[model samples]
Target: MLDAMLPVILLLILLYVGYTLVYKTDEPKKERKIHEDTQEVKEKHVEKPKKHVAKRKNPVETTAPKKQIQAEHPLLVHVLKGHTSAITACAFSPNGRFIATASTDRTVRLTLRESLKSKNPTFKTINLPYDYATACSFSSDGKTLGVVTADGCKVSLYSKFKTKPECITTFPVEHNVLSLLLNDIGEEWMTTLTIGKDDNTEIKCWNTSGHLLQTVNVNQIQNYHGVQSLDNRFIAVAAYTPEVKIFEIQRAKDGSFSKLNKAMGLQGHTSGVTDIAFDGSDFKPVNHIVTSSKDGSIRVWDINVRYKLQEDPKCIKQFQAPSGYYSTVDITPDGKWIAMTQGSALYFLKVATMQICCEIQNAQDDDITRIQFDATGIEIFVQGTTSRIIKVYHLPIE
Candidate 1:
């Protein structure tokens, strides 16, 4: 019986050891299965989210074509490259077929219209040397070009050189030419290149035939400089003796000049006169005179009454420059943009709202000397110091 009890205890110990070993092995299997189930559930949830994802369309790959800009609001299309030196002056021929640019390079170029598609559309250059060109214009027929010299104080007339330009005639003037104009038919006018110590202001008129038509003398004014004539009947003159003056100059058969019997004079600029532009189309939006001064301001006035000092020339608008002394200023023919040079920078202001448009920052540093719009108001040409080339800008039509 003792032996039987010992065997039973030994059996009980073996059973207990077996139960412990089995429980430990099964516990590991159970935990592994639960972990696997949890992993599967997590994977299923992640896969569900992926199946419900929304696709996105790329903006660069849009299906519809973009709308084009309108004609009245035409966009800028950069075209021809311009001058290499200080561009003294620029103008578009009345026909808009070519652009004339005058520079301290002592040359003027006739830039042809090339398709903007071309990567390079440079001007077919024509060489004309004046002492230094300050003012320039194309004859109405676009056949001749006139440029004033800074040193020689003369007017050089250039005719087309095989559809390019060639200097055909030159006339000597005792004074430097400050301003000039040639009408649709080559009718021309010129004013002081040098304000004389004589105190007699001189503005001369000529015809396409190269005949002197009138000589205007204004002893009362210090330096009479700009002459702009319309329809060959009405003449506008801007002068300075530290003051802005406008006088009506009349031409007679004897080739004599006289201030309008009853004239209008304007005085507002605090410094010497820099520029004046006449916009016949904007006769009402602006006065006949828009003058820029070293004082860094522009004053627009209606000197239509200047012959009569008692009659006030309407001070329509005044725009100030952003920085630098006002070197030069011009208004688009339609009276849209007023561009002025301040030191080495170019500042453009919208006439309608007097808004500053842009300060053209070239990767290459150059002083922006002069700015002018094309005849059709489509482009701007600029030049200045350290300038090796002229920049032509395609502009907005609106």
Candidate 2:
């Protein structure tokens, strides 16, 4: 009986040990599942804030569309943009029906003023094969176009420039031509040359046939500018000297150009003169001439004096630029306003008061090369050294 009881006790003890081992193993798996569930909840909580942060940034991103609209100038009327390279010179026809432009791209373009606002503005291109044009002018009748070339210093005349273009003649000049202007009848043209090998500034007159009619030396080092009166009687030149020299262009008995004689000198500025302009295109006796100088002053002279009687030209009004020198100046066709350029800025002054009426700062991207008014004086055209586009502005004179 004792042996049978010992076997039973041993079996019971083995069964209890097996049950305890199974229960302990099942408890740890439950604890691991609870820990994994808590970690998943925490991860979901962290992702919600990231989505909220992205939603909060939507308002700031909506403001970027405002920059798409560019502001345009109030006075700007038209922007002519067909030149492929920098424009060197530009001029309006005498009648204001056409505009002529010369560019470094070795092409001269003629455009109608009426078609400037069209979608495809028509441009008649005149190719310069040998060199580029440095300056250009129109005949009094607006039928002939005169262009000055850079290489060889040549003057080219074009006939029927309005419809069919023809290069009638191109002649070599003696000196480096600074500016060229055709007379009222278009038979003769005048050019101002820089200091020549003879150490003189030369003002030369030539007929369309390329014959040198007359040459006058200004006894100066550099010839900066030259312009003729509308009546074709007087030529005013600015040079390295402060005094502006006025010359009378003599004509032959048939009204053809013959020679030029020194008339008088305008003396006032302290430094070299940079540019000069006549008052208007129609002058009964040419009463006034405007000049700009390195001395930073624009002087209006009463040129109607009797210089033959040895009466000196008088400076009636003097306007000093706020800073820097004026590179170019032009009086309106009505002689009511004076337009000038200093650096890249443009200014308009009332002729009566000599006060600045309007100022357009940064009118060009670079130095302003030329500023001109239309025949009607209602529009102003501006060209720049590096900017390829020509700007046309409607003057708010009223």
List per-prediction Cα lDDT, in the order shown: 0.59, 0.80
lDDT of 1: 0.59
Consecutive 10-residue window with the lowest summed lDDT within model 1: 189-198
* Clashes per model (N, Cα, C within 3 A): 16, 0
Give the per-residue lDDT digits (tens) of candidate 2, residues 1-398.
98979999999999999999998998899889999999998987785543334345576677665567556667788787888999988888877788899999899999888888899877788999968988888765677788888887888888675676899888877777777877754444333222232244777777667777667788878777777776667888888889899988776676766667888999989999988887666434467888999999999988888888999989999899878899988877667788899888888888899999888888777889788887677888899987888888877676
Q: Which candidate number would show the highest lDDT if scored against the true structure?
A: 2
Estimated TM-score per prediction? Answer: 0.60, 0.81
- TM-score quality measure for candidate 2: 0.81
Model 1 residue 313 CA deviation (Å) reads: 1.5
Could you tell me the TM-score of candidate 1? 0.60
lDDT per residue, candidate 1, 1-398, as tens digits?
A: 89879989999999999999999999989999999999999987784543665779887787777889544212334433456576666666655666776777777777765533466654656565545677777665566667777787677777663455666677765565655666432234332222332255666665444556556565445543454433323444444544554444454555444334325555667766756666543123324556776777786665555343487777788877655466566666666677666665555677767777755444114655455565555566665555545556655445
